[model samples]
Target: MKKTPSIIAAALVLGAAPAFAGSATPAAPEPVIEQAAPVPFSSPDWTGFYGGAQLGYANIDTSAGGDDDGFIGGLTAGYDFDLGQWVVGGGLDYDFADISIAGGAADLESVFRAKLRGGYKIGNGLLYATGGYALADTNTLGSDDGYFIGAGYEYLINQSFSVGGEVLYHEFDNYNSSGVDVDATTVQVRGTFRF
Candidate 1:
């Protein structure tokens, strides 16, 4: 009778092994995460040094009763500082021309300018106003000091190249000691390479 009880107890423990394992709690599964994508395009940086050229027409009128128009072309260089929504710069320009006065009185030969510019930033460009001092040269009338004011717009084709246009009004009270007033209007197309 003692041997029978011992055998029965061992059989009961073996049979309960699978049930005990199943009754215990199972662990939770881990989570899966996804990441977001990045943007593709951005705005341009306008602060730099630049050199360029321009070509256009000039209409000249004089107090001596002469009026005429002809070609004007020039090279320019400048440095610009970008200030958040604004940009400012200073530059120089030298233009060559040979527009005649009506009745062959004189030929306007060339002009040199020292310029200051400031503008509002618009997309990939600037809408700006410019003014400066200028020296006007003529074949017969000699050279004279003058002032000019203008407005322009510049657009970037890329980071390194830009194109623009301007309209300026220039005035001189005396033409090289001749006591004749001169006024000029100029329109130009400009191209630039930036560094």
Candidate 2:
């Protein structure tokens, strides 16, 4: 009976040892995989108020009978609205220049102009048209003032920046001591920055 008990005890210990060893071994640490984060999906918005300056050339054809061309510089301010692929806006601008009629013999006059513009955005560029009024100081010849119209296109080089070119026409009725009526045309290349 003692031998039988020893055999039973030995068999029990051998069977239990394998189970205990297996439990202690720690189950191969379940595969520790990790997932990556998702990226954001959205575009930037562009609608606001902007202001800038412009420098350009102006050519005037006088109906009273003289022609003049010179450089012009000015400041501009406006508000913009972005609607899908198109953007619309209105702006006011002013420019000053020293211009003369006839020849270098004639005295220099200061010319001033104010304008309003409307534009449509096409791709990275904008197509625009503008109209306004102009005023200038004439020698004893008198002063000239009139309405003007223009059209231009601008390409956006980056956010808050653009460059453009335009052509404009102006008409002055019965201007100055010369008693001559004048019509003028101007073309200019301009650049602007937005805020």
> Which candidate comes out best when scored by TM-score?
1
Pairs that clash in candidate 1? none
Model 2 spans with C-alpha error above 4 angstroms: 1-46, 83-86, 102-108, 139-142, 176-178
Query: What are the per-residue Cα lDDT tens digits for candidate 2 across 1-195?
Result: 779999999999998997877776567778878887887542223367777777777666655456778787777677777775556666666676677765542433555666666667676777878888777565646566877888989777777887788888877777754656666676767777776
Show the colliding residue pairs in model 2. Answer: 141-177
| Per-model TM-score on C-alpha atoms | 0.79, 0.64
Regions more than 4 Å wrong, model 1: 1-42
